[model samples]
Target: MKDQIRSFILPGGNIAEIDTREVKACLQALMKREILIAGICAGVDVLDHAGILCDVKSTHFSDADLVTDKNVITARANAYVDFAVEVAKKLNLFASEADLQETINFWKHYQRVQ
Candidate 1:
């Protein structure tokens, strides 16, 4: 699974369920290998519990929808679309910059992706 995964995306949920020994261990392992880690809303708390946000800048329930620092990506709960777009950008999922803009227009601005 390590080699198969390019990034680890953590979704917001119950803090108790999200922040656990097993999850921390997994996150630590991924961190050691320098895998991109993304967390949204309460999920950012899990990353903090895992000690992944010590030197990294992050955002949670903030005015800014998305924030990326080094290998970490964070966002507020209401910024799921922005979070996804940033992740997609980091992963190079878009064929080109124009493709990315088209996606942003369609998904974020509710415009046609033309």
Candidate 2:
């Protein structure tokens, strides 16, 4: 699973149902290997609580927002387009123009639905 994971995308919402210690440990380990860990909306709280955002500029669902930092990319809610693009870039998943366009199209449809 570790080798298979090029990045970890954390979604937002009330995360009280999550197992923080396990999540933190996993995130730390992934980050140690320089894996891209992205947090969107309240998901940034998990990264923050993990102490992984110590020296990293990050943002959650707040009025003010910071851009990317270290291997972490964060943004507020409703910024899924930026978040997804960042994740794709970090993981080097966009190999061709078609791939990139596909991602854009996906998000465009998603936005319309939302």
Best by TM-score: 1
lDDT of 2 at 43: 86
What TM-score should be assigned to candidate 2? 0.77
Q: In candidate 1, which residue ranges exceed 4 Å CA deviation?
A: 60-63, 111-114
Q: Give the per-residue lDDT digits (tens) of candidate 2, residues 9-83.
A: 788899786537999999999889988888888888888888778877777433655368788899888787787
Instruction: Kindly list the per-residue Cα lDDT of model 1 for residues 2-64, writing each as its tens digit.
Output: 688899999987788768999999999998898999999899999988999988888843457
Clashes of 2: 0
RMSD to truth, every model: 3.2, 3.4
Report, for all candidates in order, the number of backbone clashes: 0, 0
Range of the 10 consecutive residues with the lowest summed lDDT in candidate 1: 57-66
User: How do the predictions measure up, each by TM-score?
Assistant: 0.88, 0.77
CA lDDT of every candidate: 0.88, 0.80
